[model samples]
Target: MRKSSFMRISKSISLIIFLFVCNNLQAQNQSYSTNSKSDFWRNVQFGGGLGLGFGSGYTDISITPSAIYNFDQYFSLGLGAQYTYIKQKNNYASNLYGGSIIGLFNPINEIQLSVELEELRVNINLDGSNSNSQDFWNTGLFLGAGYRSGNVTIGARYNVLQDDSKNVYSDAFMPFVRVYF
Candidate 1:
């Protein structure tokens, strides 16, 4: 082929190859978007907390496990289950089992505000007396605020539905330290 015609053919081939690559990339982009709609598991995060307290003839143990689905970077909703056992030697023992639904909001990168509604079933029995037992259901609404750093958040929560005498929690204010992956 002549020099000018050969150069022209090479340039045309380069343009065609560029066009094909661009079209292929665009198709891949569309495919990713479609698959992202069904990728619910990717947005889910799992986390939980464990607690223990011990004293002379007294013991308290709690287990909580939770899962949250991140709607975006700023908002998430999750469900948590809690099991707590308290023993006071020669006095009484209590078993508390509950579940809570929580909604979390991060208005800023360093702050988190959460609202949780919990329903618990409490059972109390005396050490030596089997006939005298108490079983009831209690509900608590907790509003919490925290300071966030990386995956850890330290904060306090106030229970709006706390009772002075018949309460599962000893106090209305509880502090928590949480870490999430």
Candidate 2:
């Protein structure tokens, strides 16, 4: 046989082996799913955050909703959406909308590690004038470790993309809470 023919045969064998391994792993996963009694809703979580603030000539409101899926005892993935509105005296206002992805890892009881990636569209009127509004996108990544008890999780995360001027967050460190249902 020619060198090219031998090479072709080797590539074909490698492809077959890769496909076989993938098929085997997928079959095992399917078996686990079929053997489990819990339905889809039983393995899912829903929770988020809400905020309201009122002060001198200013008011703020925020709402976030999230859903998560528990793949197993060790790891979970989630998605969330956020909306915030801020209004001040003299027609000043800002509106923000965004979405985020969350990942959690639990190595032991009551301890958790988390990472989040988010993007937001910020519309702001810097001088309280509706005629001069600006819009921009803000992206952030946060990493945290926390303790969980029952349905509540409390943790502190640091924003990896925090900027002194452009970012809206006052500081890099922020606290979070999650209630799963």
Candidate 3:
């Protein structure tokens, strides 16, 4: 009789635990469903900031600001401007204009694939005594994917560039971070 009583108590406890777990899981599922019902890209957000670019034998610290317009749940456009300080003892600098297209896909939430193009005005001071500067134009294209959480975005990209006039300054891979408010 005692054994039978203990078994009854155990079964009751098991049933209670199962019901509690099921209730919690159902609540979680409902919350997720409600959030997923809204179109993710209806809101347009704009932001910009500073960054550092490090590459082979050169490191560039920069300020970059961007404006983004989200059209729907899948596609967006971004436009940005950047100024970079090239630390080559003589303070070589460049100003850049950037544009990009962002596409959002599933399997990874809040992640986007981006394609970008940049036009840069690069200046170099050939001599320390010369007040005059040599100016050149460079253009770049990039393909990458990004993950965003709240106001922060992080990504990796492969970049290609060419100086149209001189046929110089090739391409490289770069990683980046962006924030939006």
Candidate 4:
């Protein structure tokens, strides 16, 4: 082969090899991004709250379970369930069971905001000694604000759907602590 011809052939082969390598690298990077997206469960978190109180002739107990799916670092949506029981010496006994849906937002790393809607069934037995009972359904919408750190938050919420004369909670405002894993 002539010197110029040999040199041209070598240069062409080198360019082809370089282009092939670059194409394969780009394909690999695309594949990696796809695999990363499939890791949906990694963004899910589970948590809730529990409470118990007892005193002379009075008892209260509560349990809540919740799960949230983080869409990104800034937002999440969750579902929750709650059950509560209360007994007063001779006056009454009550059971509250409920479900809720909540939306959470983090405008900054340390501040969080939330909105929650809840539906509850309240059942009460009058005069602990008799079978006289009352049952009703209650609904509440709450707006909340909190301070957040890692997987924990401390917050307060105000119920937009509260009645002054008759409500499960003593006040329209309530405080909370939340933790998730």
Candidate 5:
């Protein structure tokens, strides 16, 4: 009877030790996963760009002032406005105003995919030749992809709204560069 009692005590002690080891391993794995998720979203950022807008019968030099909001490492949204001088063959000059909303996706570290919806308008001088000046309005869309790293960004957009009344749409692939601050 004494030998049987001793064997039962040894089995109970071994079972307790095994349970303790398994619990510790599970806790360690859970902590590591939580830490990685925290590091992905702690960084916020901003930038500026300069490029050319060409379409129809008009080709203009433009400047883009931009800003961005980073919600996390995986996503961001941006806004930009562009201004340019429209130089025509008739020696008449006008001003162009444009705005855009940019969405960014981070698929890998130091790289991004950008999609944008851009709108533009041109102010024309109708009175320069007729003594009664008039203004012309033009609008269009641009869709493209971009790559970014550190403080520098570069991208190319395909012109989707290249057809307009004044032929003022940009029909070529537009490339741009940005500097983040």
Candidate 6:
């Protein structure tokens, strides 16, 4: 009877150990599967802005390219590079190049709030010849809000650093569009 009781106890302990090991393996497999779904490239977005404007004797063209990483469904961070050219009737032309750091927050399904910090190099050619030019740096902070639909976003921003005496833009309001893929 003593030997029978010992065998029964040993069998029960072995069953419990086997069950514990199986459960742990299953949990590890689930964790790995979840991580694989959100790989690095899967969370990346690519898009930018293209702008063209023409008036009586003025022309403006701009191109910007950007990349963003989605930290989750509600937040994203991005970086962008910009190039712009402007020509006026009076033989005044300007070339602007810059880079920006962007942040976005989505508090609801269709609303987005954005902020951008930018550093730009401005080259102004007083003569149409382009040989006589001046170079300077301009920095701006822009605050914006927009509506997003599908892969497109439309927004308007106001520049916090706009100064009529020193800044290139006489107006502080700018409109923008962004597409994502």
lDDT of each: 0.92, 0.89, 0.66, 0.93, 0.70, 0.88
Least well predicted 10-residue stretch by lDDT in candidate 2: 125-134
Q: Which parts of model 4 have CA positions greater than 4 angstroms off?
A: 1-38, 128-132
Q: List the residue pairs that clash in candidate 2.
A: none
**How far out, in Å, is residue 161 in model 5?**
2.6
State which candidate has the highest lDDT.
Answer: 4
Pairwise lDDT winner, candidates 2 and 6: 2
**TM-score against truth, every candidate:** 0.77, 0.75, 0.56, 0.77, 0.59, 0.73
Per-residue CA lDDT of model 1 for 18-122, tens digit only, reads 999999999999999878866887888888899899999999999999999889989999999999999999999999999999999999989999999999999
> How many clashing residue pairs, candidate 4?
0
Clash tally, candidates in order: 0, 0, 0, 0, 6, 0
Off by over 4 Å in 6: 1-38, 55-57, 128-132
How well is each residue in 1-181 modelled by candidate 3, as lDDT tens digits?
A: 6999999999999999999999999999999877765544446577777767777656667677777766665666767776766644444444343344444332345786777777767666544644656676666777777787766769877765534454224446668786767
Pairs of colliding residues, candidate 5:
54-170, 55-169, 55-170, 126-134, 127-132, 127-133
Candidate 1 vs candidate 3, lDDT winner: 1
Q: Which stretches in model 3 have alpha-carbon errors above 4 Å?
A: 1-42, 52-61, 90-108, 129-133, 162-171
Q: What is the C-alpha lDDT profile of model 6 across 1-181, one tens digit per residue?
A: 6989989998999999999999999999988887877686799999998889999999999999999888998899999999999998888889999999999888886988889998999989886576667788989899999999877889898999887765578788998787878
Kindly report which residue stretches of model 2 are placed more than 4 angstroms away from their true locations once superposed. Answer: 1-38, 127-132
lDDT of 2 by residue, 1-181 (tens): 9999999999999999999999999999998887674666688999998999999999999999999999898898999999999988776788999999999998986998999999999998866466678788998999999899877889899999997776568898999888878
Between candidates 1 and 6, name the one with more favorable lDDT.
Answer: 1
> For model 5, how does the per-residue alpha-carbon lDDT over 27-120 read when each residue is reduced to its tens digit?
8888887776665434435566666767766667877887777777778888888887866655567777888888777777567677777777
Prediction 3 TM-score vs. true:
0.56
lDDT (Cα, tens digit) per residue for candidate 4, span 1-181: 9999999999999999999999999999999988787777788899999999999999999999999999999999999999999999888899999999999999999999999999999988888445568788989999999999999999999999997655588999999998989
| Global fold similarity of model 2 (TM-score) | 0.75
